[model samples]
Target: MADSQRTSEPINIVHQDEIWKAHVKLEKDSAEVWPRKWGFLTDIYKEYKMESVKMKETLKVGLPSHEVVPSLTTLQKHNHVGPSPPVPQTTQALIGWRSGHAHLQLEKYSTVHHGRRSFLKELGWPFDACY
Candidate 1:
């Protein structure tokens, strides 16, 4: 096993007059916080929307690399709550786009899955409403 040492300097218990001292160095640390004006799930959606606009502007200027897009290149390197290996902004935007697309797919699927429920409701089959 690797040797374990006390974080602070060693002190002699036998010396009644000696004082014990421990020093801790302070450093800036990165932290994640919620932003105002947008919901959690919706924030990614908004990012996706803005990124798309920037992407169009990049194309208009004939930029060589899509990576030149500020939104794509501005991914945070150290987000405490982000995924391991660090997700790129472009990848996150794609994920947001896909997620929105999936919701549409689900709504489409509801026509099939909820057909019976809708039919029953149309026939006056009263149901308790709850969130």
Candidate 2:
């Protein structure tokens, strides 16, 4: 056997098919050989159930309301996960160069589509609707 490394030819359809088959076979083998990990929602429910049990035990001792753990909804609200932040008035009001370029393109698009006697009106919108 040669010690030197050798480059292979570019893959064609047959090679690609073989590679895909090998990948699918490997995944099947892995699935059969190992147990699947707990799903995301399952893990979250498990944690919530465990925490609820612990909290029940703690509450039996009559802990103060201030010391009680906050509910998930309360946590989400405080973390700004429920309601979205206000949209900026202009790209200049935003903090990044990418946003500026994006907003400029968006403004141009809106003007082209929403201006008075716009492209849609010129094309006879009601009649051209199907196309």
Candidate 3:
């Protein structure tokens, strides 16, 4: 493949935090004050949409290898997210685990997996509405 044919795609080089952080402040305050629990599900759906965009960006760039936290490379797996190994004494490892779980959840609930047969039967969502 020649370099000339390469498309000028804007790769997201920053981390997921940066991506989500940049646009989070622009959201309007929730107005569903009554019931409190009333429509929190809708708000969650909105959040999922935003995170979905960022995740897609991260996916496009591909996860980078980190020297400071070498094991972070493990999170790049498509089906990542499981219990961390025993003896997680460092904060970095915990943070990595959280990040991996969050990413996996986004995918589990994304429109990309909206309707096909799934092994994750417990996570089944209504086929009519989704992120």
Best by TM-score: 2
Alpha carbon lDDT of residue 92, candidate 3?
73
Angstrom error at residue 124, model 1: 67
Q: Which model, 2 or 3, shows the larger TM-score?
A: 2
lDDT against the true structure, per candidate, is 0.51, 0.68, 0.62
Query: How many residue pairs clash per model?
Result: 0, 0, 0
The collision pairs in model 3 are: none
Model 3: per-residue lDDT, tens digit, 17-126? 68776666444234435437577788989999999999898888654666445455655764454664454578877665643554445455554734667544557755
Q: Best lDDT goes to which candidate?
A: 2
Alpha carbon deviation, residue 52, candidate 1 (Å): 0.5
Candidate 3 weakest ten by summed lDDT: 26-35
Which 10-residue window of candidate 1 scores lowest in summed lDDT? 22-31
Q: Which stretches of candidate 1 lie over 4 Å from their true place?
A: 1-38, 61-131
Model 1 RMSD in Å is 25.6
Q: Write the per-residue lDDT of candidate 1 for residues 1-131, one digit (tens) a residue.
A: 22245646665575634332221111111112223423566778989999999989887766568656556335554322322343447865656454354343435445554334465477676566423
TM-score of 1: 0.17
